[model samples]
Target chain A: MKKYNAVFACLLLVLFTNSAAASSSLEEYFYASGKIKVVITVAAIVLIGLFVYLQRLDSRLKKLEKNKIEK
Target chain B: MKLWLKILCAVLLFYALLSSFYHPLAPGGLTVDIEKLVPGANTFVYSGYNTHFKDHSNDGLQFFVSSGSHYYPTEIIEVIDNNHAKVNVVLPDTLPSEEIAFYANTPTDGTVYIMKPMDISAFVFHQNYTNGSVPVKVANDQHQNFGYPFQVIIFESIRNLMWHVPMWFTMFVIMFISFIQSIHVLSATGRENMLDSSMIYVQSGIHDRKASASAETGLIFCILGLITGSIWARFTWGAWWTNDPQLNGAMVVFLMYVAYFILRNSVNDEEKRARLAAIFNIFAFVLLVVLLMVMPRFAEGLHPGKSGNPAFSSYDLDSSLRMVFYPAVFGFILLGYWIYNLRLRIKILESNEEI
Candidate 1:
């Protein structure tokens, strides 16, 4: 859990810096074409978040099944 | 839970995803370049978001300026392009009302109008000025196209409705399941007939596991809903986070549920933990209702439906939107249930292994 927290913190730092660097262009890109890119960005976030959550759950279940076999 | 239901959920989601992006937006007024209308001839460019002015230029394209009940016709100088037109309207020296509105009518795009406050101090205002002498042809035909209503700031981002709204709905359904399971956990302890205390403990333990599993799933959805809503708010409402009552309420609900998990984990004894967490869950659910449902209605906020009896106005959930939104809601709720089911099975297995 501590390892996961560290990884997430690092990921957030990278994302924040990257966004800060290209904030102007990113805002322009999202606002252009009647702000359709905003919708795409939201959809991408939902899809990726759900996938990541499912992957974590799958790994945890795998660990539990392995422990049961060992016992 | 059932194979058929899972397939139906998949199909509904697919349909929602397809239709949400596939449908076009109805033509609406975008902007009029003129700042103020003077007494003499006023020529300004009119731009539309999704309209065909060029195609209908020679056809039935007409423009009008309306003041109160009187309509004054405007001459179309030129159709610049499909979405642009230069219009010239001559206003009378004495006007009935200073409140002026511009209207554009086309064969394909129907009628789109823009109302802007004009600097009408230059023109003398007469209450009984007869400006209705000229016979003006106003096309009352609605836009024939079947599409989502085109909102100004929320143009294509309106599509986010299908994705963002369903997350909260799904969270509500999952949390309700968690609430019901928590009630079972509390009630199981009240039975007097059970001679074996171990039996009650086992039964309540199963309910506790189910409750926690569903709550976990509900929390995931709640987070998703918050993120999506925040993103939507940024572009439309000009901020990622607003002090809107609904928004603050949602944030509090999220924190409260996080507290629920912390409370569950802190207690070591199984029976005591279940009993305490169940009571806390009941309180959390009640708080959720008051914060999200009851309070938002009374307070004025940026979110629509606040200060209004219904959650959404008729214009917000038009027939075209309903076609896609209903399926999206059902799909997400089923998906939440499916996730909760899987999580509950895992929790039950883990608890059994502990025994």
Candidate 2:
């Protein structure tokens, strides 16, 4: 509890001190010069493909878990 | 899963992913060179975003300085490229407002507004010519074509809606299925007598497996949603995480499910574990609803669909977006279910070995 309280206070101090400084640098990443359709499509496909791969890995892990439990 | 359903999910997701990039946004924003205007002839370099300005050079392209309900017309000097132009606006003797917004209209490009309003009174000069009255609202000459709405901050990141939002939607759906299976597991105790003893035991095991498997798949979706959401937030909100009600609430919900997994591992008795986990699952789902959906709308947050921010439904997800968005939602949900089924099958095989 004492550690948590100290960490919380540190966070509060950082947030207050950084509030004004944070607004100076605006986000400019992925601005895409007004044309981002290709980027969007590519990102969507990659993420979807990645999730599919994860699902396959999950199934394999489940199979391993089943085998270990059975043994 | 049915073979046809699996094929449909694949086809629909492929279609949604491909079709989302096909539609273009309507010309709805302008980037202007000058931020301050004096009472005289002002020539500002205007750049159009997601607009075909060169194509509409033959049509009447006009500019305006507009206050509430009134507009002062400007002269278009030249078109530099397909998406850049120069316009000249002559300020009158008396200004309509200290700050006025810029509006541009072309027959092909519809109407576009500068994201930032220019201060007309920033620089003062002698008033030589007085325009008698500010021109009232005139009907836009150009007909708007079907396209995505161009917003300033979320100009392109608006596309994140199709990918990010559907993740949570799919997660909720899978979690709800787990919740239902958990309830069934709790009630299946005495109902076991309705079937053969061994068959009833298998049925109860199946229920337990399904409940856990769905929760597992839901966890995967939840994590993906958070990752995708964090990327979108970094671009638009300027931070990976903001102190918004919705974001904090989502984090809380995710932590609760993590705790759920820990709880499942602590218990040794199968029946006791299933029962306790079921009750915890119901509680977590209730928290999920209250935190992610209900609580955010009551407080001011940077996320859309909150108290201060305008919901996207009003303007962002135009008809073209909805065409792909609805299919994406369905496709991802089906894919989640497919993953859940695989997990459930593994669980059943493990339990059969025990018997």
Candidate 3:
């Protein structure tokens, strides 16, 4: 619970400090949209890859059972 | 071919379309001019639409504005042209950090999307303007989320094509299978020989209380089609039930199929039950076509294609949407067939043991 509280406070500080962020030359919001798009694409690729991997494992198990029966 | 594949493809298509909800097909664009558009500032920035001055096309976007945060319809004074307009007195000021909502009624096109629609429900609140630029993103000053990237092609009433239209295809396939099996049974050259008469055939039982696999699959598709259809109605028409002739007729057909099952179970003799149900299936199907397809067009309905409100056959399909909608239909129908085949096998085994 204390750890959670610390994390929450950190989040609050980051949010409140955003207005002050304009002083920095980086202007993080400018890259925000592109960063979001990259995250979405990466997540989608991971999910689709996971689906294929799981499906392959399932079929391989079935094949092993078939081979054992034949032997 | 599989339920998972169909659901995945359909959901992806829905999400893709949902992602670009604001883009429209027409040429003219939307513009919000803040011509001194501050409150108590009567002659505020003007908001309207623009057609390519080249094409002379017009999209309507008319709005009334005032500074006090309260919009009075009395504010709109006159229309100078298709693009520009005047309004009544607006207050020149507002409270600090305050967001005042000014209402714009865009009934026609998206070229004039000054009024932001938050949901399907919010669409009802705005006054109707014709010929406005379709909105790409609903802008809210509260969020500062400007210019949403939604590319929605107006597949109006066609989304119903997914749930309402495909049931017929599934029904037709099941009915066709039933017809073929019936023919096979009749041509088998002998009955009471117990082979032809056996309720033991899973395809369409010969002598037992179990219904054929085809019938169960048919019932599942019919029932699911009915349910999704009613849910689709909630989003499209905002009501669960309407006095649509086609809707009523389809309900009757659905109930008739339910009755088909009950009537199949009530009888004890296998041969009599199979023969009777087969005959009824043929008749019920013919009635289904007449009710779901024929009656709606002639009877006039709230549904599309029937009442001339909208029809897929009448419109050109955008290549993007056709890619998704067509596959979804095929995938779902194929999955329906797989379910039927499974049910048929179960019936055959059950009948075999009755000996």
Candidate 4:
């Protein structure tokens, strides 16, 4: 349950960080900057999603190992 | 499961990644320095983005003023730089409106046009060259081989179609596979209950596991798709999220799947969870079709294929784009399937108490 809460907090942090970066960069940068920023944001999202997915899989594997040890 | 298929997916995606970045945007759009024009000799400085006007001499460049379908030739005064030019446009006796479109053409850039009508505010200006209707002078229609379409605003962002669109397409394919698996699980359970035996329940559990695994992978792709889409929207539409129908529909579909996961976690019994989730999955699939596909077409939205915007077919993905686009679609779909397959195997191992 604590792990789940931490994951949710991390997700919220990512969401807020993304929105803040998007709004600030648009105001700060010119035309060409927009493209680079967009590419970075997209790549970041994919990497984060994959990371979270792997974390879930790791937790499941841990649970299976715990059950095996108890038996 | 096959090594060769996984290798192929990796190779195709690598090719797509390389090609999307390497290809350059074709030159287009003519920007004018002046906003207003008079009937007599008027000078307007012209420039373009990614244009090859510098390659052409004063003789090679042509300017024209177009009102409706009728075009009147303008005299080119000087070719200052490759990107910039000075034009002496003599106003015609009469224009359709107070504002008229100006166009510039080069052998390499084809025709770069500025459709923002420059206001002809001067009362003394009149076309004295011809008494009758002046025939529109057509510019040279020379095509340059740049290997990509050059739209005005979309410019370089056209490359995102390779990465962003395929994510959604791959997600849809995986979700559809999940939907099919869910149906099989429900039917298998139905058959077993009718026979008054728990034997078929084992088989149905496997199907249920596969279905859930597919949905899990599909959700990952969906999240990636939405994130990429939002980034694209920020640059193109000047907002992270718009009130567009297609965008809203996609969000709703994503939310529906989130609810599915929540529902699955709430139910403790394996058989009951599978049965309930399978029913919900079928309902969600139907809603996905309606929200993402059907409803967007009828309403006005900023997205392509909506009422106001032009669909993908209108632009016509020329041979150049199709070369990379088709491969990207195939690669992403294969990759998605591979991930789902791996997840399903893990689920099977878990249920059997195997490491």
Candidate 5:
């Protein structure tokens, strides 16, 4: 869990710095076509977040089974 | 949790995912280049979004400048492209009203209109002025195509309806399950003595595990809903977090549930911890209902279904949107339940190991 927090902090730092840089072309790409890329970005965030949660649950379950076998 | 139900959930989710992004928006008026209307011949380039103007140019493409009940026909001087047309209309010396609306009709796009505040100071407003000499044909038929309604500023981001809304709905369902389990825990404990047999305590423990597991799953969905809603608010409402009553209410509910977990972890004794958490869960659920459901309706907020703004049911959630939205809601609820089921089993297993 601590490792995941560090990873999330690093990801947020990168995102903030990238937005602060003001990359016009990247901004233009997202703002094009009535800002449809905004929807895409939102969808990506949801899917990634859910998948990460599923992975955590899977690992925790595996760890429990390993402990049971060790006993 | 059955095989068929799981398959149905997967299929419904797949359909919603594909259709929400794949469907196009219905053609609607975008803008006109002219800012002001004059007394004589007025020409402007009319532009439309997803409209087939050029293809239907020969199909009796007509334009009208309508003020009140009178309609003055305009000539389509040029068909510039599929979505652009040059229109010219001659205004009379006197008009019934200052507010004028432009209308374009085609067999494909039906009747699309734009009513923007323009400078009509040049025309005189005679309330009884009527133009009976000019033949007016106003086609009131709408486009026969099935597409999401085109809205200004919201444009294509309206597709987020499928993803963002269902997250809250799923959270609500999961939390309600948690609420029910918490009630069961309280009741089971109430029926027995303090130092009861191990079997009754175990039963209450199972209920406690189920309650916390469901709440944990519900929290995941609530966080997802918040993140998606924040992104959507940033793009549409021009702010990541608004002072809307509904938004603040959601934040409070989130923090309250977090506090519920803290209350659970603080008490080491299983019976005491379960009773305390169950009582807190009941209060949290009531607060959730009040904050999310009851308060938003009475307060003025940027979200739809508020005090002043029209609800999505009245205008926005059209037939095309309902096709995907209902499936998405059901799919997300099933997915949430599936996750809650797994978490409950894991919690039960971990507790049994300790005993």
Candidate 6:
């Protein structure tokens, strides 16, 4: 839950902060033939975020298991 | 299956159905029967009648009008007739003679027939004969009229219905489940784990302070619903909001449920919160159904799916659109279910330990 909340917070920050900037940056980032640094940064964040979410889920499941054992 | 997966599948199906049945109005196609608007280049005569829905008009001309939610229309061609036969010349804005030349986008099978040699062969032949003319040699050199197919791009924002509305539905369904569980906890104490009642009602295990899965998801869904709805309204209705009773009623319903969430959060006692929240959920859902289903019948809105609106009926629903839109709604609902389940599981995990 903490991890989900953190990810949510990060998403709100990155996305809402950039709604006005999307037309230019998103076009540059996702345009079929466009070349720019924004695309690379967006790609990196997605990969890193996915990694973190999975890690958090794994840890949460483990914590649940540990509690179950002690109980 | 995961709830999100089901919702995804449903949404994809809905879009596929819609796309299959609903086609954008294209220009230069054989219009079943519509008045064509022609431009003037020295000559000033409209080749069709003036009407919103009919007049055998020429194709390829675009008009900009502020209709509904759109601030500036992309482009619209006026239609005024229905007969596939010959048409009239609307004056003040059309070419003078049948031999007038013009350009447009690629022509389709159904686009207006340009007044050319084929369309004017009889008129010219009659004039030549009246002038004591010998049979003129057939001249077939020019084809200035290229058909610009009629292209109408509708707002695909109907796609958001799958994403936003389902969130609320799923929220309600989950909240209903929570409501049921809370009642069970309150009613059956012998083996139902009385200490964990708070998970079903107010907060989580010891200090998580997380309300029921239904409440949080419901709130999120409500927010998303408003944002997407406003966007759709801007594109379709020409305004973010109108005096439509259905819209107002829905807003009221949403606010009521949001208040329910606030109410649940305000009261801290485990026993009082669970019982009260459960009761509130029941009332809120009942009101939601009433507003969505009943209020629309009495009051008119820019929304199409109501009874009196011809726009939302079979006329608008072509076989093409059914392919996509149907599945999308289902997919969204399924995804909502998935989210609810995941949240419920998380709550259970949090509550399992007595710490």
Q: State the lDDT of candidate 3 residue by residue for B1-355, as single tens digits.
A: 4678667655654543343332232322233344333333344334343322212223334454322233433244555655555555434233221223344443333322343221122121222322221223322221112222221221222334444455656766775676566555443423445664334344344322223566666666666566556645544455557788977987898888887788778988766676777667667877877887778889868765665576543333334545444654664466566655555554554445445
Query: What is the TM-score of each predicted model, taking all chains together?
Result: 0.93, 0.83, 0.49, 0.85, 0.92, 0.51
Q: Is the docking of candidate 6 incorrect, acceptable, medium or high quality?
A: incorrect
What digit string (tens of lDDT, one per residue) describes model 5 on residues B115-229?
A: 8889888888888987532556665437665676777667788888888889999989999999999999999888787556687798889999999999999999999989989
Task: Sort the candidates on TM-score, descending order.
Answer: 1, 5, 4, 2, 6, 3
Model 4 Cα RMSD, Å? 3.9
Q: Which pairs, if any, clash in model 2?
A: none
lDDT of 1 by residue, B1-355 (tens): 9999999999998987887688787787788998877887999998887888999988988888888767788899999998899999988888887678788888887788888766777788788996643556665436665577777778888888888899989988899989999999999987737658889988898999999999999999999999999989988898889999989999999999999999998999989999999999999999998998889888989876666533433654347567778999999899889988988898888787887
**CA shift at B25, candidate 3, in angstroms?**
11
Real contacts recovered, all predictions = 0.67, 0.12, 0.00, 0.33, 0.54, 0.04
Q: Please say which candidate is ahead in DockQ: 2 or 6.
A: 2
Q: Kindly give the stretch of ten consecutive residues in candidate 2 chain A with the minimal lDDT sum.
A: A23-32
How do the residues A1-71 of candidate 1 rate in per-residue lDDT, one tens digit apiece? 57667877997897688679897776787889888888897887788777767877888799899998999
- Per-residue alpha-carbon lDDT of candidate 4 for residues B1-355, written as tens digits (9 for 90 to 100): 6999999999998888777777766666647888677666668887776676668774467777665565667777777878777877776555554446777777777776776645555633244423223564454334545345656666667778777888889888999998998999899988974775567778678878988999989999988899889878877888879999888998998999999999999999989999999999999998998988899888889987677677554554445567788898898899889888878877887879842
Residue lDDT tens for model 2, B192-277 = 66767676665566777888899988988887777777767766777879999988998998899999999999999987788789
What count of clashes does model 3 give? Answer: 39
Error of 2 at B187 (Å): 1.0
Model 4: fraction of the reference interface contacts it also forms? 0.33
Ranking by lDDT: 5, 1, 4, 2, 3, 6
lDDT agreement with native, every candidate:
0.84, 0.73, 0.48, 0.76, 0.85, 0.44
Winner by DockQ: 1
The CAPRI category of model 4 is acceptable
Q: Output per-candidate TM-scores for chain A, rounded to 2 decimals.
A: 0.70, 0.48, 0.42, 0.62, 0.75, 0.47
For each prediction, how big is the interface RMSD? 0.8, 4.0, 13.2, 2.5, 1.3, 9.0
Put the candidates in DockQ order, highest first: 1, 5, 4, 2, 6, 3
Winner of 1 and 2 under TM-score: 1
